[model samples]
Target chain A: MSLIEAPRTPTRGRRTGGINWEKWGWIYMRASGVVLVVLIFGHLLVNMFLGEGVKAIDFAFVGGKLSDPFWQVWDGLMLWLALIHGANGMRTIVNDYATNPKVRTVLLAGIAVSTIILIALGTLVITTFDPCPAGADPALLASFCEAL
Target chain B: MPEKSASNLVAEPQSPPKIRSPKRPAGTLYRGNEGMWSWVLHRITGVSIYFFLLVHILDTALVRVSPDAYNIVIDSYKTPLMGLAEIGLVAAIGFHAINGLRIILIDFWAFGAKHQRTLFWVVIGIWLVLLAGFIPRQLMHVFGG
Candidate 1:
């Protein structure tokens, strides 16, 4: 076995005139890396810098942010983009290291399943979150929610 | 046996396992081991940050479950143990971000590709300064009484 595996499959193999997934995957890493920096840093700054800093963070802080659709979309985008980016990176690593074809298939399947499930759950939470539910105890709700 | 050897010769024509010094194109410079180290670190930081992202998303999503539920998870992070972990998270993110920028520059800028070693050092220098600068402030926030 060589230190680096032969470039196989889509990167260097016979093609039947279809979309080049490997090329797109390469492009996706660079593109998503750029965006994740903004989404991630903005997230850190807001959570730990603005307002009263990390000390102010609690259910209310998160609840207030989720109440706004702007933050919801921002959070949702961060969720989807970063998850896919991470999953794709894992897939590349797995492909590079996994020597056995059957083992590789199983590993890739596991990644796909976990990534799909997390993305679904994350998207659902971000979009459907009701910071102040009708049935929740008034005492537990954010003060702003009490007005409603 | 003779037929098999003939087929092996044909296959070797394409796969060419022998060491062959291919011509360097008109004008290009080698980036050396420093370039290789940068590639290795980039991948390592990427994987580390991705792992952090997984845990982070799960914790924040707990907010939607219930206030008590979320508080249970988040409040635990205030412990000294988790505070120490925060330092590691910040370092991973800082390295990944700067190295990512280096990669982007190398990809787009013709000069960056030529001097990627220099760019890598620049990335490291910024990362150290940021990490050094962040430690005092963040440690205070994390472990401050």
Candidate 2:
């Protein structure tokens, strides 16, 4: 004769004692997603829908925005959050579809490398940006460039 | 008596095993309902947004190169074709954002799972309203000047 456990009895745990990276990753997606929605929407509204809309966008427009410390922080946060969020999402998709171990490894590596490089590059561009560069067409410069 | 017992212990002839198909054809959670469709659309839009983000970051990085370089590249975005593409990009982002919120609600809220079917339509309703406000404004910007 055998005895059965109660309905509410706890079962043996599947996960070993360690960090739960997957759980954190899952939480990161939703958290970053909420932030990115605000960041990216504000980005689009300012860059694409304001005043002259897309017509008003150019080097000058970007220079003007990037020159401002507020936008610098905005773009920087957007860059890190959105890139990591997207890279993680792509990792999930790749894990699902890429059946071959080698193929999956390669795809995952590509995502990781690209995300790192872009994040670094984007941060550099935002931090060290010069609104007005010398020997450039003065006509194309930001309006504030005239004051400078 | 021993020989008879040995003969009885012999195994029966074996047959080739047949592969058993699952009782459910599509998937466990996939019932062609709002849940399934919402999941599918979320993935599609997520992927599209990812690719666009990569390109967008590169374009913006051109600012560090030179004003001429950045302006010359960004100038192409004002073209009629790219203008239309912007609409699609915005649509994807809007859907992804709203639906992402819906997904969060389902995960955290007490009543969310029970009302998820309703939430999917709510996501669509909000997405449509956003696009309605955006499209006309964008069209005038794209085709106006």
Every prediction: chain A TM-score: 0.85, 0.89
How do the residues B1-145 of candidate 2 rate in per-residue lDDT, one tens digit apiece? Answer: 9988777667554576998997767655548889999989999999999999999999999999998888888999999999999999999999999999999999999788889999999999999999999999999999995
Model 2 error, position A65 (Å) = 0.5
Q: Please report, in order, the local distance difference test score of every candidate based on alpha carbons.
A: 0.81, 0.92
Which tens-of-lDDT digit does each residue in A19-99 have in candidate 1?
989899889988988998999888877876455456567787788888888999889988988989999989999988998
**After superposition, which runs of candidate 1 have C-alpha atoms over 4 Å from their true positions?**
A1-13, A135-140, B1-32
Candidate 1 per-residue C-alpha lDDT over B57-123 given as tens digits, one digit per residue, 9 for 90 to 100: 7888887788888877888776767767776777888888888888889888999899888988999
Q: Which candidate tops DockQ? A: 2
- Candidate 1 clashing pairs? none
Top candidate when judged by TM-score against the true structure: 2
lDDT of 2 at B118: 94
